[model samples]
Target: MGRVLFVTPPLTGHVNPAVGVAAALTARGHQVAWAGRPEIIRRLAGDGADVFPCAVPRRLPERDASLKGPAAFRFLWEEFLIPLAEAMAPGVRAAIGRFRPQVVVADQQAIAGGLVADGLGLPWITSATTSAELVDRLAGTPKVAAWLDELLDGLRSRIDGGPADPRMSPHGVLAFTTRELLGPATVPHQVRLVGPSIGGRAPTCDFPWDRLDPAVPTVFVTLGTTNADAAGDFLRAAARGLSRIDGIRTVIADPGRAVGPMGDTVLVVPHVPQMAVLARVDAVVCHGGYNTVCESLWHGVPLVVAPIRDDQPIVAGQVVDAGAGVRLRFGRAKPDRIAAAVTRVLDDPGYRSAAEKVGASFRAAGGAAAAADHLEALLSG
Candidate 1:
């Protein structure tokens, strides 16, 4: 049995998918372990998961909500990704020495895994929790892409590693999306569009399941984990907009407690069992986080996507291009616009049809099982 080590960041979206893949590997009689933030890995992968501790910045101050476009991209790489890679380099190396796995499954955002593994002459595969990087969002912006290359070069030098693109592994990439959503975007040969790794996440907080009314149209609204600070206004707008429509229930995830109070018709909470809720909802309204968008589509639920920053616009574009949802301006969307988008998605059957089509493709792509198959192939090859 091959020993597989998954190296992920502390982010829930990234780790959640890896959890599913690791579980698949374990079920196949292969040994699997994790190297990341122990607290988060344990929470999402269950306390029994074999995990090695890693260090993150003591305090990662939230990004300015107004930052967008190129600025946001630069900030993500410089402020978060680079620092995170550097901070994690030692832990990743130590984990490699201790766990001594034959293969490493590295989260695209967690470059340290690739860098450290490359330095130690071990094979690594990218666990692409999101499909944004796989399609090359920077293809049009040569200068921006060049700038990023330089930054990565500097990061590699700091970690004393040879040249290599940490984002894409030469061995393989387990992309959590498929061509159905990606449209005609040119994908690299090494990428395996294995669909979203949906299950195997340790159960999260409970929801008020009884509050959901099957008679009324239900819309699940969320901005995902990282965007809570920027989500307050959008969540309020969504609630107001959904309220304007009669016989519609809105379930909003307000992780930051941005929304104060709401009536029984609108359920506001700090968090929701997202996957469980998606199964019951008629529609979704979200910030277009790839994971959330993919999960919603997995359940054949249409969406109203308001993209904020960092691959969200690219993901939102895919959703619109696929005819699965409507896009709204994150900052300028008022209640009327929000309501209008939701109304269009909820009333029009075409959106749901598109989402169901995408969902069908996802199921056929084999999800985590296919991802594990590819991993085993890598070892055999």
Candidate 2:
């Protein structure tokens, strides 16, 4: 049995996909451990998970909510990704020394895992939780692409890594999405479309099941874990919009406490048992976070995607292109627009049909088990 180490960032979206793959590896009699924040790994992966602690920034860099497009992209790499890799390099090296695994599974955002593993000549797999980069958003912008390349080169120099992009491993890339959502984007041979690693998450919240009215159409509203700061107005707007519609009920995951009080038709909580909620919801109103979008589609539910900064715009566009959802502007979307989008997705069977088709493709792609199979092949090859 091969020993595998999962290197992940503290972000929930990145770590969640790896959890299912790790479980699958363990089930196959292989040893699995994680290199990331112990609290996050343990919370998501479980209490029994062997976790090697990595250093994260003292505080996440604060960015203006107004930053978008190229500016947002630059801010992410400069303030977050670069600083994160620098902070985590030492700890990743330490984990490698102590664990001495045959292969490392690194999250796409956790650059240190790939850098340290590549430096040590260990085979590392890239776990792409989102399909944003696979489509190449920077294709036309040569200057931006060059700038990113130079930035990565500097980071590589600091970590003593080889001249390779950490985001795409030479060994393999486990993309948690199918071609159904990616459209005509060109992907490399090393990338495997393993779909969403859907299972093996331990629920973190106790949802009020009895409060849900099965008599009416239910919409699940969330902006995911990281967007609490910027989700206030959008969340409030969504709640207000969803509340006005007749025969429609909504469960809003208000982690930011953005939407204060609502009527009998709306249920607001800090967190939700997402998978459970998705199963029953008629539609989803989200910030186009990849995990949420994929999960919603995985359950054959449609969405109204209001994309925020970072990779969200790309993901939201993909949702629209796939015919699985409607898109709204995150900053500029008004209540009426939000309501109309949700209503359209709920009423029109085409959105649901498209979502179901995508969901079918996701299941056929073999998800976590397929990802594990690829990892095992990498070790044997």
Candidate 3:
């Protein structure tokens, strides 16, 4: 059995997928160690994998918090990334040396993993939570492109004495999204579409599968764990949109205190087992994160995606094109428009049928087991 070191972002979205891969590795008798935050470390430990804490800033000070908008974006670039990267570099290097891993699997956010792997002359794999091309595509835009260039330049400067070009990094990229979602692009030879690594032991909670009335079509609303604040607004808008629908029950999973009171048809809960819930729902209203999209597709549930930020737009666009979902402009969204979209999705049977086909394909891909097999092959090679 080979020693594998998995590095992930502090956020749950990134950590959860990595944990899935780690669990698979451990099951296969390979030694798996993860470097992440304390909470994630605990979760990884629970999965029977050794955990190492990556010394990145897991929480921001209350005084330093900025409301989401242009200000948040600016703060992320200027205040967050610069300092966080600097502080994290030593921890990444130390972990790599101490673990002496045969292979390093890292999230895209932890660019330091790639740098450390390169310096140590070890094999490195890049795992993406969303579409792999998200950063590159965003950087290609005319206005925001410059900022992306500067960010890359800054990362390069931190790595080497002088600014290092991003193209010089030699690491294999593994996208956790499907080809249908990522679209066709001339990705690097090292880049591979490994499908979504979303495996986990079934939740302890007793999901109310029996209570779901199949006669009345159901829509599951989830904003994901990280961006629950944005999801709350969507739930309110969707509640208004679905209010008039006679036989539709909307289930909103709001773990982040974003969801509020809705009509009789809408059920608000702190959290629900996503896959279990998706299994019972006819459709999903989501933020279009790769994990959620893949879960929805895996369950054959059609989608109404309101992409709030980041790679959400890309995922939303792919689902829409595949005839499995509808992508709405989040900025201009209102209750009526959202309702109309939901109506269109539910009224048509084709969307659900198409989604089921994709779900079958996703299931056949073998999820994290396949991913582990690939990593094992890489380690041996």
Candidate 4:
């Protein structure tokens, strides 16, 4: 059996997909382990997982919450990405040495994985959890693009042993999205669309499955785990809007418990088994993170997307462009607006059809199993 090591940051969104891919490899008789935050790996990969400890620095506080465009990109790279790569370098090397993995599957955001593997002359593949980075959000901003290139180049030089292609691996890059949702765009030669790696045993959460009425339309709402925005207002608007609509039941995944108890029509919990909820729900109301977006469509569920920031707007655009969902202004959308969007998606047959269409493409793309095949081919070649 070949040994495989996965390097990823501590984020839930990134680690979850890796769990699926690793599971696929393990099922095929390959030994797989992870190098990341032990807590995150253990939580997602189960308590018995073999995980190498890595030190990730505390995120540098954002100078301003509303920073957008170049400023937002600057804050991400300068304060977080660069520092994260530097902090993770030693651990990445240590993991590689100890594991002696035949191939390293690294998350696109974890630059240390790609660079350190390059440094040590080991084969590696990129595990792209979010498709946001695949599209160029900075098309019109030439200066910002040039500046980012130079910044990344400098970071690569500092890391020093081998060639760096940012988050992508020259050997193979696995993107967990299909072009049917992404729209036509220029992609690097290395990236392969393997659909969303939707595996892993579902997390146990106190979900009211019995209470979910199969009669009325059910909407699952969440801003995702990493969205730092205050969701109380938007979630409240969702509750007010959906509850007022005669037959709709709203389940909001509010981690902060920010939203007050709305009546029996709406369920408010700090968390929900999102995959389980998504399976039963008719539609989704969310912040448009790629994981939620892809997963919802994977289950043939349409959405009412309210993009908060970062690559959210782009993802929302993809949903809209593909006719699978409707987009609303996250900050300014009123209760009525939220209601109307939900109603439209539920009532319109076109949105559901589009969602199912994308789901078909996702299934055909082969997901994690295909990703493993591609990775194994790297070994054979």
Clashes of each: 0, 0, 0, 0
TM-score (C-alpha, index-matched) for candidate 4: 0.96
Worst ten in a row by lDDT for model 3: 160-169
Flag regions of model 2 displaced more than 4 Å: none
List the lowest-lDDT window of 10 residues for candidate 1. Answer: 156-165
Q: Which parts of model 3 are misplaced by more than 4 Å?
A: 44-47, 58-79, 132-135, 138-150, 156-169, 201-211
Q: Which scores better on lDDT, 3 or 4?
A: 4
Deviation (Å) of 256 in candidate 2? 1.3
Query: Per-residue alpha-carbon lDDT of model 2 for 225-331, expressed as tens digits?
Result: 99877988888998888899999889999987878889899999999989989999899999989999999999999999998888888899999999999998787
Comparison by TM-score, 1 against 4, better one: 1
**Which order, best to worst by lDDT?**
2, 1, 4, 3
Candidate 3 residue lDDT tens string, 1-381: 998888766666777678678888988899888776657656534645566666766565332312444555566556665555556677777787788899988777666666667666778777777773534564445677687668767675676422322223345666676666556655666666677776654353455465568788898888787774455566777777777778899887777666577767888777787767887888888878778898888888899998876556667888988889998877566888888888888899999998987777666666687778788888889
Please report how far candidate 4 places residue 90 from its true position, in Å.
Answer: 0.8
Task: Record all residue pairs in model 1 with backbone atoms less than 3 Å apart, i.e. clashing.
Answer: none
What's the C-alpha lDDT at position 239 in model 1?
A: 86
164-234 per-residue lDDT for model 1 (tens digits): 68888888989999889988878899999999998998888988889998888898999999887698888
What TM-score goes with each of the models?
Answer: 0.98, 0.98, 0.86, 0.96
- Rate residue 376 of model 4 by lDDT: 81
